[model samples]
Target: MDLLRVRAARPAATGAVLAAAALLAGPAAVAQGDSTTQSDSTSPGTTQAGSGWNDDAYRGEVEVIPGDDETADMVSGVVFEDADRSSTHDDGEKGVAGVQVSNGRDVVTTDSEGRYELPLEDGMDVFVTQPRGYQVPVDEDNVAQFAYTHMPQGSPELEYGGLEPTGPAPEALNFPLEKDMGAKHPHQSCVIGGDVQTYDEDEVEYARAGAFSDLAARKDYSSCGALFIGDVVGDDLALYDSVRELSGMLNGPARFLPGNHDLDFDAESREHSVDTFRAQLGPQYYSYDVGKLHVVALNSIEYPVGDGYNGALGERQLEWLRRDIAEVPEGRAIVLATHIPLLDFADQGSDVHQVDEVAEIYEILEGREVITVGGHTHSIENLRAGDSLTGWEETFGVEELPFTHLTAGAISGDWFSGEMLEEGYPTAIQRDGGVPGVITLEARGEHLTERFTARGDDGSTQMSLGLNTPAYRDWFAAHEDDAGEAPEFESPLEVPQEDLGEAWLTANFWMGGTGSTVEVSLDGGEPVEAERTQQMQGEGQRVGAEHSDPTAVQQQLVHGGSIADRSMHLWRLDLPEDLASGTHSAEVTATDVHGDEFTDTVEFEVID
Candidate 1:
């Protein structure tokens, strides 16, 4: 119901900030009046600032501000320690003097005290850049140590609430300063996922009932945390509470990055662009360190009001990013998480949504080991080592998925529409055949291996039935008139048992209507019709969203035709049994509503 409008056409320059402003509005609007201020002096609180206010002197400070009228209460502070903890400002930990802090649009900052004051917003998160040498505290759980907890009355109520330790605000929000003690490289891992955009309560339930449930069951990530890359909800901000509740199930800390859909539609300026997102999910963009990795989450959505917007990082955020990444050791591997992919995928020439500052971001980490993850496309693409796509300046796109630049498929998969499965979720088939799921990365030292887990398959390698179009033509015409139309195809495209391999029959039956089933058989065996369940998967135009009439446009934005047509549906069937080494044949059949039936056969070979 809260859908934000995506631009119908692509912008001329992807780097223009105005392009982003023209596309979508979010919550973090820059405020017109001076920010609301709160004095910590009213209640005695610790204050620390460095010497030589005007002179170039290494200085640092911390403060806690309560929630108030003009702005929400915020307990924000910064760390001035550099990587070596020498108490000297280094490359990446340089303090960003006069940087504005806020719960949302209302902003404030530290003065000569390196101390800032402001009332926290409900569910607001306050964090400061770790000034070069100092490090913030890490909870026993290894959640990045923070300066304060602003949930005065604990986390708010919802399906999923705030962090597990629900209660009033802590006595004093203080971050003890300490040098980064030379310790063993922390054995840490962070779960990176793209687009958990739940459209409605049902989709939320689907997420809860599926991959999320699986994630909650694992205690492995109790150390580092889970970082979701954007589109938290399809269009519904209300789902944030539910998402938080689900995250509460995690064994470790959970953080979020803003995507296009996460934008507050009512947001008026760049500052207020991600207000609700920040309030519920912490900073829109922030950096943290874990083990040997320096993870930086960036806000890619540009909400330019005056000048044209581009897909690059906002000027302010970019400046902060330079400072943030500069502090890390050149040897440390950095992971950048955002919602939109920095490079083009299905659409290469369009600039309406790709990051314009790709080169700038690249320059910042020119020599450092870096990997990036994004989601907005709702399809899975692996930019392996040496892979390069069009539109990306050669220097920027040539590297293989250096550490895996994964375009995580959306959680809502094709917009949460399709055949309803027993799981009470739609079997939303993706155009590319990748199913809805999450990605897990195992990082030991500088080496990281990426694994994708589909919703129903657990940890099995994602394999879908690569259904070609020809097979569906006969099936569609057979049931063209039936209300509950389906392909008149037979079960199991017969294949020698050995050639079956580990293939899931993803029937791309362009004509199969709702409730269609495709049963498969081996040799002369009974048919095992792969169940028709609705789950979101892949990329391309989903069945329901409004699109410009195909006749009106010479080119279609998404591949494939509309799913609304009975002839436009695609289905998938997982091979019931693993294939042995050799040749095999499968017989597939489809049943139509009028009792009509159609059959087909396909053969293949599988080697041991």
Candidate 2:
């Protein structure tokens, strides 16, 4: 807390007094680019007592005192220079303007000269918005640079070094910039991940052991940082530090967007809704560029701050986004990342969760090649050419991936309560029957390919059953009381192994009644019953914690809640352990109570 005393202002003989004050501040006070000049004036109460002046001839001179604390309360430094000459913020240069600068609560902007002053709380994060045309400086090895350090005395120590230990705020937090070079598409790749809501320490371990572990082992993302699109934690803010540690496991930088669960539960107004998140992470909505891609991370959870909702980007953030995106070159691609899927497979009509102003957002990105990724709905959904999910407003009928709308499944699959695997992690199954993993977008000069890499397995072709049911109604209800019952099994009547090799039957049955059976037979032969094991599956039933019968309640509580009498049966049928590598036809059958039955035949290919 070094405080410099404000010097008394001397009476000016003319308009030159203010210019003198600028000189005393420092040599860096000279305007970098702007031409605005300062003017000198006197207070109304000041009277000239000199020889030539009468009592009422002159107003009192208002002394401008340089407060003993000349240091900015919030932002201590600015990285105004883009040292790499990339016109984008790199490792060591300054930050950009019109970016939302904050000290956790009071947000402000930088002046034309890229100079800003905002009040800061005791322990706050003062970050800049990496504007479109210019980039912040990068370090020696090319890590995106951070602004000045401003940690007040006695701020809590970062469990893992939170902010770099760089002393107090600098006198001038000035960032440098460079002119945007003319048209040329740069090779760019953006990393997109869906929901990573870790509920507890063990689940955090699951995340660490799963995809994150795989991410740690690779070096592919060293140049392009990782962007996690919401659901950083499962409603636990404490996991933020742990999450950061996970990011460190990567060879590149990692940024995050606030998911619904990442929100401050106790936040009252829009200003405060994401206070904790902002404090722990950075800004709620911000834009940055990597190569030719303009990445805009938005806060889509519009809940009430003081008077209205805070989910969608409010007028202020929306305006900022408009301006930010406007600065991006027409040829560049934009990636909008958020938590709740702007469009999703689950809950297509729920207004509270989906992006309300989807059309407006699309309009913002109409002409550009844009892609959106989200994670609230834990499923791996890829909308390729000519595909549109049900319930989307016609205006938002995304004909193509319209820049790929992918829903990254959760790391804690189905809440991490599944049966333990040989690897010691829960078999937390995914809703879409797809394995839990990360989606890597291989972007080589505008052309993009979507690849799904399962957590424990190498990146490979992933196919799972999308089971649903219009049959087997009674069987689902009969075993409703059993704690553990076999899933209604289905046997494949024919094998397409020769024609469609390496394909797995992903049974996405909807009414998998309690205790029902699903068996599959290759070659239209005898059906082998697939075991119905509870690995934390689908959003489990929700029930009251305190009940009259504790024993019965305890038995019913499988992972987080009691399995309802009839739950949807979503299962994946793997090829037989000893089946030869070739095409195989199989018949599947589901037997319900009251001697009723439903059957279907499908073919799949297998390869060694």
Candidate 3:
């Protein structure tokens, strides 16, 4: 064993991001036009990044040197600096010391010589935790190649082919890293997406036109890149290749965790469930560092023998988590990401949609500055510290939040169900009334901020302002069960004289929570505080059409989508019953915990 050496901050000669081998960014390009027709011209694929012009997937791969002739008991590797930009380490290349390597449970740092050895198991993933300032090699499709899967017997018979059997353990699974200044810079933007969930070729094109194109147009996240926190596909694992192609369309390297839908239903056991996903995407769970932040991507779903799936991390993974967290330096900013949320406001009542061991996980990171992000719930919830929910306390025993728990809204909102827009995608209005979008986790100095950007829309599209009236609620009650067949809620914004007393202005602030505030101003008057529907403190959920967003529900009712029956981010303020019956314009503003304000306008009327 050799003593550790400090890694220099300097980068290699090549200026391109070696991990993504991102095609040279030039002037922007416009994606293919949409086929669907719409009165509004706002659509996805209207503008795109240069990466879409040439869908290059020339990024290299990981180098796995075969083991010796005799059966090996260990999987060994050297973490080296790829000075010449090759994915493989040449004889002249030197190993970088102090880089961490793992075999699911054991985490060992490289010595001065940059070599590490771990006891190997039959179905373990041998991986390297990408250190700060350096990036691991990526496959042709921009999928990071930090880990190598070792499956001796492969998976038991499954619908989609699992990992191909590796006859013997590799002698050396060397990982190559390239220096990148942008990756370690203090200011970083990391994109988190939920539920790409493309079920068919048409849905694939929808994703291409929707979020993927949106991601392609943005060049901000070259370092931390984008992490699709599961549901990369819908049921069919063969679509993994298509998803990989989608990743190649990104302007940066892409990482993904396994969602429940990305499962192998034919598997006999949980051990081999996501084998094909691991082979196609990265590991089932892993960690990496960028600047001062450490991100741990976890596989939160658990499918058992003779049972359906649940939101439980097996003991094996729990032990791995213990080891993984122990390795991170104390006080380092940690971002815990999962496919199914650990704890969320949307599914605060369900046992399966939330992690079963949330309290235990919280205990593990007690002293650190941490924020958790997750997918699968298909809603945007930004629950801040000290926020509490009745079901959260009863089900998970979490009295109040220790830190932030964010439910990153889905890219394929409401599973691509709604009126087809000219954007070539459905208006996937989420169950929370939030439009389909992705979360951008930004690091600013010591604080990390999370912002949601709607698909094909600007940052100004943060909140939806509308009127939720008694008449609209009655219509919702009538059409509640008529999904995909409901008649349009007639004149939703116009409230009759009788219902005006009970009508309220609603603002669906997508990322609003306990510390956030929503204010309403009628006809340029003073802004009045709008009450949040759910306080998230020991109260049973108040769900019904009354709590729903009129803007989203109106769109969902006639077209087809998840009805916005209840949302934690919703706020309502009663309209003045004595106001004259005429057209009136109101301004709604939502201020988040970070003190950033988003303003939107709604024009409504009172009728006789």
Best by lDDT: 3
| Tens digit of per-residue lDDT, candidate 2, span 68-94 | 353545444343554545434345554
* Tens-digit lDDT string for candidate 1 (297-409): 88888875354444657776787777666556665667788887776443334575678787677677766666677877766654433434433434244332333355766
Tens-place lDDT per residue, model 3, 81-189, is 8887677779989999988888888889999988999998888988899998888767777888888888877777777988888778887789889887666776677
Candidate 3, pairs of clashing residues: 67-171, 388-536
Model 2 clashing-pair count: 87
Worst 10 residues of 2 by lDDT: 55-64
Model 3, position 279, has a per-residue lDDT of 78
- The Cα error of candidate 3 at residue 490, in Å, is 1.3
TM-score of model number 3: 0.90
Candidate 3's C-alpha runs over 4 A off are 1-58
RMSD of each: 18.3, 23.2, 8.9
Q: How many residue pairs clash in each candidate?
A: 96, 87, 2
